[model samples]
Target chain A: MSDTLDAALRLMRAQAALVRRFDARLGGLHGVSLADFTLLLRLAQAPGGRMRRVDLAEALGLTASGVTRALAPLERIGLVSREPDARDARVAYASLTGTGRERLPEMLATAEETADELFAAPAWGERDVPVLAGLLTRLGGTGLRS
Target chain B: MSDTLDAALRLMRAQAALVRRFDARLGGLHGVSLADFTLLLRLAQAPGGRMRRVDLAEALGLTASGVTRALAPLERIGLVSREPDARDARVAYASLTGTGRERLPEMLATAEETADELFAAPAWGERDVPVLAGLLTRLGGTGLRS
Candidate 1:
């Protein structure tokens, strides 16, 4: 394999490892997966703690139907709610519930703590984090501002 | 969010984007997704072009059940076959068929081309590829030697 192809495979494997780790930690402690945490976090960062379903799908790299399927469980758990746009009945929005807002900080803290440990100590140095983030941004990754 | 957390999110998003791109290209041309390609590639790399089901699961970061499910379609399509251990009835192995070996090169070429284009533009410098691979290695990603 070429170096670029190797790098691509490495990225995929690393991501799988990262998600497994986060899912174990976040799921065990917070009753949420990394995906759910991301959804709630995006809502928290949005202008009104809400987003149009299509926009949220784009942000999360999911199809509209995928977003709907993902939100179904959260909605059932009262972490998110659906709001119909008054002027455009065809438009629907997904907004974080008060429960979601209240619970996000704890989830964010757990995510941060897990992330910190992953980059800490013998494996990674101070400079590696930013370097990796820069490369990932080239691939259209977000969350740099946050 | 801390830079560490941001980096984590970026990794996830970037991986998703990469998968989407690879899926589109590989699926369009080869009728196989990246996961299928990886499975076949790994088998080709093995000493006998085969591996125990459990070992395949570990290498792919999937469960035994997941590996079985993934292999089902490939097996049905004649890209792979299941071999039962002659002495140990309990052991099962997944081996690439002649068809899989013949078609894998084209699929690999497509993956390489997609990966090359992703890192080729104004976004990435020559040093970026090695640098990113090194960082990902710290996270337990492999494929560096290949």
Candidate 2:
């Protein structure tokens, strides 16, 4: 394989491994999967603490059905609430509940810890994280949120 | 969030987006999911083109059940076969079939093309790939194979 392709495969595999680790850690500690945490994080950042389901799907790179599936557990736990858009009844939005906002910091902390552990290896220097993040952001284009 | 944590999240989200794209394209063009392609790639690289199910699980960062589930379709399609170990009756190994070997190049080619398209953006220069791959390798440890 070409060097570029080889590098891409490595990146993909590494990310997969890291995600599995994060999911296990986050789920065991906080009862939230990585996907759930991501959804909550996005909702926490949205204006008025709410986002249309379609936009959530787009932002998360998930299909409409996927977004619905990911939201079900959160809704069940009262972490999120579904509301019809005031301007358009056909449109639904997912809003973060007070409990969800309260719980978000702990999840973010866990995610941050997981990230620190992954990058704590001696092989990764101080500058690597930012450099890598920039490349990933460029490669991902608008798919990755700030 | 701290810079390291932010970088990690970006990497995770970017990889997720890329994998989804790969799965869609590979599934549409070659009838193989990205996970399946990874499995086949691992088997192809194993000695004698075979590996224990447990090892496959470890290598893929999947549970034993997850490995079993992923293998079912590949086995049904004659891409893999189960063999009882001579020394351990309880252990079964997954061996790649001739048909699987025949079909692997096409899947790999598709993956390569997908990688090319993703990195073709102006933001990624040729030098960036090795540097990014090196960082990912460090983060991933031995979990990521060549």
Compute fnat per model.
0.83, 0.64
Residues A1-146 of candidate 1: C-alpha lDDT, one tens digit per residue: 99999999999998888888899889999999999999999999998899999899888877889899999999999999999998999889999999999999999999999999889878888888998898898886532221
Cα deviation of A40, candidate 2, in Å: 1.3
Give DockQ: model 2: 0.51
Model 2 over residues A1-146: C-alpha lDDT tens digits?
66666777777778777777888989999998888998999999999989999999988877789999999989999999999977898899999999999999999999989888888758778888899998888766454332
**How close is chain B to the truth by TM-score, in each candidate?**
0.94, 0.92
The collision pairs in model 2 are none
Number of the predicted model whose TM-score against the real structure is largest: 1
Report residue B116 deviation for candidate 2 (angstroms).
2.1
Sliding window of 10 residues with minimal summed lDDT for model 2 chain A? A137-146
TM-score of chain B of 2: 0.92
**Per-residue lDDT of A69 in model 2:** 92
- The sequence of per-residue lDDT tens digits that candidate 2 reaches over residues B11-113 is 8777777777788888999899888998999999999999999999888777789999999999999999999999999899999999999999999999889
Compose the digit string of candidate 1's lDDT tens values, residues B1-146.
99999999999998888888898999999899999999999999998899999889888878889999999999999999999999999989999999998999999999999999989968888899999998998886432221
Q: Is model 2 an incorrect, acceptable, medium or high docking prediction?
A: medium
